[model samples]
Every structure is written in structure tokens, then in C-alpha cells.
Target: MTAFFFALVASFLAATGARDQLLVAGLRARLGPAPGLLVVALASAVATAFLASWFGAQLSQGMSRDASTMFVALAMLLAAFECIWPNRTPRPQEPTRSLGAIAIVLFLRQLTDASRFLVAAFAVALASPTLAGLGGAIGGGAAVAIGWAAGDALESKVPLRKLRLGLGLILAVLAVWVGLTARGLIG
Candidate 1:
């Protein structure tokens, strides 16, 4: 349960990264106002959670504790790098005139988000499969909701450069924390 909770929290924070917000907005604009969008989002969230849980379990079970810690540390470091060195040029906005197209875009965007993988893997490593799935569903769903709400606000209020720097720092800190915890340097 504790592992599930941590996964949930970490996933939420990671998902809320600025790049994801842009993708979701792009998806929403393309999809327009469609009821199917909700369904797609929910389905995507559940499927992602399930997959993540399974993978995380495999990783946790197969790897030594040191290996697991190293993997996570490396992932975190890479994430930090991406966050810090984001593409500076803004993507050309595409006009999404249909709901169906928007749904597809959103789904694809989410599929590529690192948080989905991290959350699922973390959940699996931290707890039983059932717990990991449940945690992922809850965390991913909440993250989508939060992203939807904050996407526009963040775009308007926060500078992308600043957001990236902050996220990079946070991810780095998390990597250190996870490494220490895994090594039993922290309780």
C-alpha cells in the first residue's frame, strides 16, 4: 500500500510535467467536444496502469536490489536531462476539427509520456500486482484531470524554461532519494 501510494504521488507529479500539458491540449483541440474522449482517456489510463504493474513486477522480481536502484536512478537522470534540455522551438499548432482525431492524438501523447511507465513500474516494485494496478488507475486518472485543468493556466502563467528547470531539479532530487532508499541508506 505504501508503495502504491508513492507510485501514485510520483506518477501524478511526473505526469503533470509541462510537455504533457501541451500534448493534452493539442489532443483536446483536435478532438473538440466529444463524449468519446472521456472513454478513451479512461481506457488508456486503465490499460497503461495494468501494463505498468506487470512490468514493474517483472523488474522487481528479476533484478537484484542494486540493479533495480540503478535502473531507477538512470531513468530519473534521463528524465531530468529531458526536462532541462527541452526543445525550444514551439511546435506548430495543428487545427483539430474532429473529436475522433483528437482522441487519437491524446491517446498517443499519453502513450509516450514517461510518467505512465514510471508509475506502473514503481507500483509493481512497491506492492502486489493488484495494488499496483489500482494505484496506477487512480494516479493516472487524477493526473489527466489535473493536467486538463491546469494546462492552459500553466501555458499562460509559467515560462517553459523555468518549468523545465524546476522539473529537472525535482526529478534529480527524486532520483537521489529513490537511490538512497533502495540502498537502505534511508528508512
Candidate 2:
């Protein structure tokens, strides 16, 4: 349980740090204020936790070290690509910024975030299905809240370039960590 808890927390932190900047940027651009940003962030966390927990359990049942490593690598590479070659087109304007729309946007954003999946996988592996679900929800919710607060506060203060660099570094580190774990370098 202790090990699982540590892994869950570590993985969550890693994933959140890796994607925070991009998430914040999107929120800032789309929503444009601290309150709206918070709503989106909270919605994202809840949606991610639910989705991750549901999928993580299914994946964990048949997951292997090699497969996990490959998945992680692919995710890292994809994240790198997104950071280096982001789609510059402005987000499609939504006709209505309703609560439902906000929910959909938040859920979609989290669904695309690889770190959430990684954390879910870790949680599922470390604990039973029930625990995995709970852990994912808790972790995802906390991460989203934290990311939202940080993003809202630092949106104007920090430069995008620096955020990208930091995200890239974190993704690289996570990729290495996943590789090492797959190779049995770490337990």
C-alpha cells in the first residue's frame, strides 16, 4: 500500500508538472479569468479521475513491463511533438460556453493529457480495482486543482518559452523513469 501510494503520488506529480503549462495556456486563452479557470480545472480533474480509473483497471489486468514502457515512450514522444510543433490555429469558437460545454472541454483536455493515463496505470497496478479508482480520482482532482491555481496565478507572470522548456524536461525525465522501470533498473 505504501509503495503504491508513493508511486501514485510521484506519477501524478510528474504528469501534472509535465502538462501544467499547456493546460494553463489553454484555459487562459479560452476562459480568461481565475474563476472560470478554476471551474474548468476542477471539471478536468473529476473527468480524468473517472476516466482513468475506469480504463486503468482494464489495462492493468493485462499490462506488462514492456508494453508499459512502450506506451510511456510513445506518450513522451507525442508530448514532445506537441510542445515543439504545437497547432497554432486558434481554438474553434464554441457557440455556447455553457456548463455542459465547459465539462466537455475539461474532459477532453484531460483525456488528451498522457500523464493522467500514466498515473492511472500506476494506481491500478499498485492497488486493487477499487483502490485504483479511488486513488485516481483523488490524485486527478488534487492535481487539477493545483494546476489550475498555479496556472491562474502564473499565467501572466511566466513566459511560455520557460514553461515549455520545463514541461519538456519533465516529460524527458518521465520517459527515462518509465524506461528504467521497464528495464528493471528500478523497482
Candidate 3:
């Protein structure tokens, strides 16, 4: 039980990297200080968590612990590469439309996110996919809230280039940690 919750928190921290912080910041800039940002972020979190958990459960069914750990470690490694790589440039100027834009962006980004995979893998370990999914949704939503607040406070003062680099470093650390754990170096 404790481990399950720990994974939820870990997933939140890992998922709420610079990429998401910048994304929320961009969404805020586009929407112009609307209250609906939180709604969309939370909604997207719930939807993404549900899907990710289900997928993880399906994938890990009948898998051994070592295999599952390897799967998660590899995922973290991939995420490290994603974060380290340069981010995509913003598209041409387009007027903001509705909350759907925010939801879509959040959902798409989270579709194969490390956090979702972590939550799903945790669910497989705990044999409680629904609980893991719920916890992941809350954690993901909290991450968004944190990102929104940070973005709002730092807007225009900090360079996103630096933020992106920092996120890559964080993911690299996480990947190392996961790799070590897989190799029996960490508990």
C-alpha cells in the first residue's frame, strides 16, 4: 500500500517535468488568464490516467517482477531522451478557441508519458488498477496546478530553454535511479 502511493507521487514528480511546465505556461499565455485552465488540466489528467493504467495492467498481466521493472526502467530511459531532445517549435499564430485545445494538448502529451507508465506499472504490482489510476489522476492534476502556478509567477522572467535543459537532467537522474534499482543497486 505504501509503495503504491509512493509510485503515485513519483509518477507525479517525474511527469511534471519542464515540458509540462512550459506547456501549461503556453496554454495560459494563449488563453489569457482564464479559470478554465485548471478544469481542462484536471480533466485531461483523469482521462489520461485511466487509459494509461488500463494499458499498463493489460501489458503486465502475468509478467514477472523483474520484467516489469525492466519495462519501467526502459521507459524512464526513453523519457530521458525525450526531455533531453530539443522541444518542438510553436506553430504559426492562431487565435485561441476553447478548452478543448488545452485538453487535447495535455492528453496528447500524456498519452505515452513516463508518469502514466509508472502508474500503470505500479497498478500491476498492486493488483489494483482502478486505485492506481485514481491516484495517478490526482497526482497528475496536482502537477498541472503546480506548473500553472510556477508558469504564472515566472512568466517572461525565465528562459524556457533553461527549463527544458533542467527537465532533461532530472529525467536522466530518474533513469539512472530506475536502472540501478533494476540492477539491485537500490531498493
Candidate 4:
């Protein structure tokens, strides 16, 4: 389906250099490859994507097509800003190495990340929350799996900050164009 493929690609692109993916990669670097940890990451991503898509579906029930488009554009703008912003939160000293703690942290990060927002927006736009959610889950899961497999190599070999900045700028431009079209200012 169009919705599925679109969300899959968008979520995958959005997940690059995301905080959740970075955190998992960092943990893998420190702890070595752990299948259990990858499972946790996948579960968290799936849950976040599903929740967001569901919320988007609910939101779409009451909104007009233009309103949904406008809202999706706004979400894209927020994600762009997040990607462009420097992460200022200092890494906290780990009080515990529990998998539960890791899962909680990963879940929280994914809940607020760009990919989830995109998943939600796509769900609203496409009117197919289930497909959008599944696509987003798979894409986001793949990103986390890559992080797990690559370990420290990801950080060393890739320019994550630069990649994210580029993504941010692209998303911002797309958002503006979408917003303008939604407002009938341009098509």
C-alpha cells in the first residue's frame, strides 16, 4: 500500500541519528551485541509507533482534510526543529545497568522522536493507521537493529550530527511546502 511504503521510508529516514537510535548504539558499544537488548529496542519502537498512529487516527476522525494536512505539516516542522537542535542534555551516570531501565529510557525517547511523529502524521494523512504503524515499526526496528549490529562503528564511521542537520533542513522545506499547499497559498 502507498501508506505503508511511504511511512516505512519516512520513518527510516527520520530514525537516522535519532536520540533513541543513538542511545541504543551507545549501549551496544558499551555492552557488546545482545539479542535481548535488540528485542527490547524493537518492542519499544513498535509500541511507540503504534501508539502514535492510533492517536493520529483518532485525531483525524474530527478534522477536515486541510486541517489534517496542516497538522501533519506542523508535526514535520517540530521534527525538523528537533533534528536541528543540539542535544544539550548531559549523559547521566548510570545508577543501574538493568535492562528494564534501558527499555524505559528507549521507550520514552522513541515516543517523542521524529520517526514517531512522522508515523502519526502519515497515519492521519493516509487514513490507515494500522498500515502506517506497522511500516513505521518495521523501519524503526531496522534502525535499532543496525545500531545493535554496528556498535561503536556507527559513531566512528558516520557523521550523525551532519546527517541529522541535513535531514532537518530537508524536512523543514517539505513542511513549508506542505503547509502552503494545505492553506491553498500554493500547489
What are the lDDT scores of the predictions, listed in order? 0.63, 0.56, 0.69, 0.88
Residue 13 accuracy (lDDT) in model 4:
84
**Candidate 4 residue runs with Cα over 4 Å from true position:** 88-95
Better of 2 and 3 by lDDT: 3
lDDT of each residue in 1-187, candidate 2, tens digit only:
5424643564355345434434544565555555766666666665676566566567666777577565655556555444444335443454244656756766776675644555555545553545554555566666666555564454456554565556666766766777677777896
In terms of lDDT, the poorest run of 10 residues in model 4 is: 87-96
Q: Give the runs in model 1 whose Cα sits over 4 Å from its true position.
A: 29-32, 85-104, 149-151, 157-161, 177-187
* Residue 161 miss distance in model 3 (angstroms): 6.2
- Quote the lDDT for 150 in model 1: 53
Name the best candidate (by lDDT): 4
**Residue 92 CA error for candidate 4 (Å)?**
5.9
Collision pairs in model 2: none
Task: Write model 3 residue lDDT over 128-159, tens digit each, in one string.
Answer: 77878888887887877776666555536756
Off by over 4 Å in 2: 1-40, 69-95, 124-153, 159-161, 180-187
Supply candidate 1's per-residue lDDT for 108: 67
Query: What is the number of residue pairs that collide in model 4?
Result: 0
TM-score of 3: 0.75
In candidate 4, residue 96 scores what lDDT? 42
Best by TM-score: 4
